[model samples]
Target: MASTKKTTAAKVQAPIDNRETFVSLQKSFADSDMPVEEKLKTLYQLQAADSEIDKIIQLRGELPAEVAALEEEIADLKERSAAISAVIDQLNRNIADAKLAIAEHESIIEKYQRQLETISNSREYDSLNKEIENQELLRQIGEKTINDTRMEISSKKSELEDLKDRLSIRTEDLAAKKTELENIVEETAKEEAVLRERREECAAKIDARTMSAYERIRASVHNRLAVVGIYNGDSCGGCFNTITPQRRVEIVSNKKLIICEHCGRIIINPDFAQ
Candidate 1:
C-alpha cells in the first residue's frame, strides 16, 4: 500500500502578525494547531454579525434616497423660478423703453401739426400732413408693444407663483424624510457598532485566504451566506442540496474543511445552525 507512508510534514509557522502576505497566511493556517471546527465556527460567527448589520440597514428602508430626490426636485423648481423672474424683469424694462418711444412719437406729431398752421403753399401743407400721419402710426405701434409686454410679464409671474408653490412642497417633503432617516440611524448606531466589533474579532481568527473566499461568496450570492451547516440530516444548509452519506461523515468529523459542491459555501456541523 503506497498510501500507508503518507504523512503531513510539520513546518515551523510564524506567529500571525495580521500583516502576513496572502500566500503566507494560507501556509500559516495550514501549519498551525488550530482545530478546523474552531475555524468554521469563527467564519459562521462573522457571517452572523454581518447579517445583523444588514438587517439594521434594512430598517431604514428607502428614506435616504427619497430625501435626496426631494432635495433635487426642490432645487430644480427654485432654478426655474429664478429664470422666470429674470424674464419678467427684462419684460418690464422693455415696457419702459416702449413708453419712452411713444412719448417721442407724440412730440413729433405735435410739432408737425403746428407747422401745418404756418404753411404758405400746397406743397408745405402736404409734407406736414404726411409727417403727422407717420408719427401717429408710430405712436400706435409703441402702445401695442407696451400692452403685449405687460401681458407676457403677467403670464410669467403666474408661472413663477406655481413654481414657488411646488418648491415649497418639495422642500417640506425633504425635511420630513431627512428627519425619519436620522431617527433610524440614531436608533441603530449603538447596536451596529457593537456588532461590527464582534465581526472584527471573528474575522481576525480566520486566515486571509478563507476570509477572501467568504467575502467573494457573500458578494456573489443573493442571501449573502458564506458559511452554513447541514440541514435535515441529509442536505446542505445553504443550497438545500442532498448530501451523500460519505460527505456527511467528513463534515461531521470537522477534521478537514468541507465545501458544498453545489453552492461553494463552507459546510459545518449542524449544531451551529441553531
Candidate 2:
C-alpha cells in the first residue's frame, strides 16, 4: 500500500522599493484619463503647498542669525574673562615675589647692623653703614613693587566683576532666544512635514514639461507664484493685466495651458482659485 503525503504552498510577499513606487506613480499620472482642469488643479495645489512652506520659513526670519550672534558674543566674553583672570594671577605672583624680596632685604640689613657693632675701625663701621643703606633702598623698591601690583589687582578684579555681570545678562538673553526659536520650530515642524508630502504628491501628478515650466516661472517671479487664477473676472491675478474675452474663454475651457503675457504666469479660471 502507498500513503499519500499532504503538500502546502508557502505565501511569498514581494518587497516594493522607493524606485518602484516612484515609477508606479509616474505611470499613473502619465496614463491618467483625468480632465485638464483636474491636472491644473493639482498643479495649483502644489503651488499652494510650496507657498505655505515659504511662509513658515519666513516666520522664522533672522532668528538663526540672532542665535549665532549671541553665541559669538558669549565666546568673546569668556575669552576676555579668561585673559583678565590670567592677568590677575600674574599680578598676584608678582606681589608675592615682591614680599619675599622685602623679607630678604630686611634679613640682610639685620646682618649688616650686627657687623657694624663688631667693627674694629671707623672705616669698617662706615662700610657697614653703606651696606645697610643699600639694603634699605632695596626694601623700599620691593615695597613699591608690592603696592603697584596690589593696585593693578584691585582694578582688574573690578573689571572682572563687570564682565561677569555682562556675561550673566547675555546668557539670559541667549537662553530666551533659544527657547523662542525652539518653540517656533516645534510649532511648525509637523505642519511643514505634511505640506512637503502634499507638495511631492501634487508634483508627481504634473507632467514633466508643465512642471519644468512651472518651476522656471516660479523662480523668475518675485513672489515665486507660477500659477494664478483670474481675479475680478477679467484681470490676471499675478500681474493685474486685463484678460481679453478670448483669453478668458480659452482659460475657462481648460482645453490648453494659457499664460499671462505680462507676468508669464499660468492663468486658470476664477472658479479654481482657493
Candidate 3:
C-alpha cells in the first residue's frame, strides 16, 4: 500500500481593510456639509477673545483701586490745605484786629496830647500823662501780635504752595496712565478681530466630535495641543511618551481612531520607509 500524505491548509486571518476605512472616513469628513473645523476655530477665536477681555477687565479692575488711592491721597492733601487756609484766615483776622487796636491806641494817644494843652491844674496834667502811657503800651502789644501773625501766614503759604504743586503732578500722572490704558484697549481690538477670523477658518475643517475632543483636551493640557504625530517607535511627538507595541500596531494600521493614553491626543504614525 502506498503511504498516504495528509495535507493541512494553513489558517489565514482575514485582513482588516484599514486603508479603505481611513480613506472612507476621510472622504466622509471632507464631504460633510458642516464646516466642523471652522466651527471649532470660531470657538477658539471666542475663547481667545474672552481671555483677552478677561485680562483687560482684570487690569481695569486693578486700575480703579490705584486711581482711587491716588485720588484719596490728593483729597487728603486738599483737606489739609483747606485747614491750613482756615488757620491762615483766622491769623489774618487776628492781625486785622491787632491793627485796629493799634489805630485806636494811636487815636487815644493823640487825644491825650491835645488835652495836655487844656489841663486846668497839675493834677489833670498828671492824669492825662498816665492815660497816654497806657495807650502806648497797648499799641506795642498790638504791633507784636501783628508781627507774629505775619510770620505764621508766610509759613502756611509756603507749605500750601508745595502741596498744590505735588497734587498737580500726581493728577497729571494719573491722567496719563488712564489714557495709556484706553489706548491699549483700542489697539488690541483690531488684533482680536483678526484672531477671531482665523479661528473660524480652523473650525470649518475639523469635525464636531473631533473639535469637541480637541477643545476639552486643549483645556486640560498645559501645552494646549490635542493632536500629535507618533515618532521614533511609537513615541508621542507632543509629550514624548513611549507608546505600547499594541498601540503602535493599531496606530500604524489606521483601522479606527486611536488616542494616546498618556496625553489623550490623536496619534498619527508616519509611514515606514519602504
Structural similarity to truth (TM-score) of each candidate: 0.72, 0.73, 0.53
Clash count, one per candidate: 0, 0, 14
- Model 2 TM-score? 0.73
Best candidate per lDDT, number? 2
Residue-level lDDT of model 1, residues 185-232, one tens digit each, is 998899999999999999888877778867877765556666788888
Q: Over all chains combined, what TM-score does candidate 3 have?
A: 0.53
Relative to the true structure, how large is the alpha-carbon lDDT of every model?
Answer: 0.78, 0.80, 0.66
Per-residue error (Å), model 3, residue 149: 0.2
Candidate 1 ranges with C-alpha deviation above 4 Å: 1-41, 55-70, 205-209, 219-223, 229-242, 245-256, 269-273
lDDT of 2 by residue, 1-274 (tens): 0011322113211112235543453354445566677987887788889989888887676687889999999999999999999999999999888899899999999998888878899998888898899999999999998888889999999999999999999999999999999999999999999999999999888877667767877766666677898988899887787999999999898766677766767788667664
Runs with alpha carbons beyond 4 Å of true place in candidate 3: 1-51, 191-274
Q: Candidate 2 local accuracy as lDDT?
A: 0.80
Please identify which of the two predictions, 1 or 3, would achieve the higher lDDT against the true structure. Answer: 1
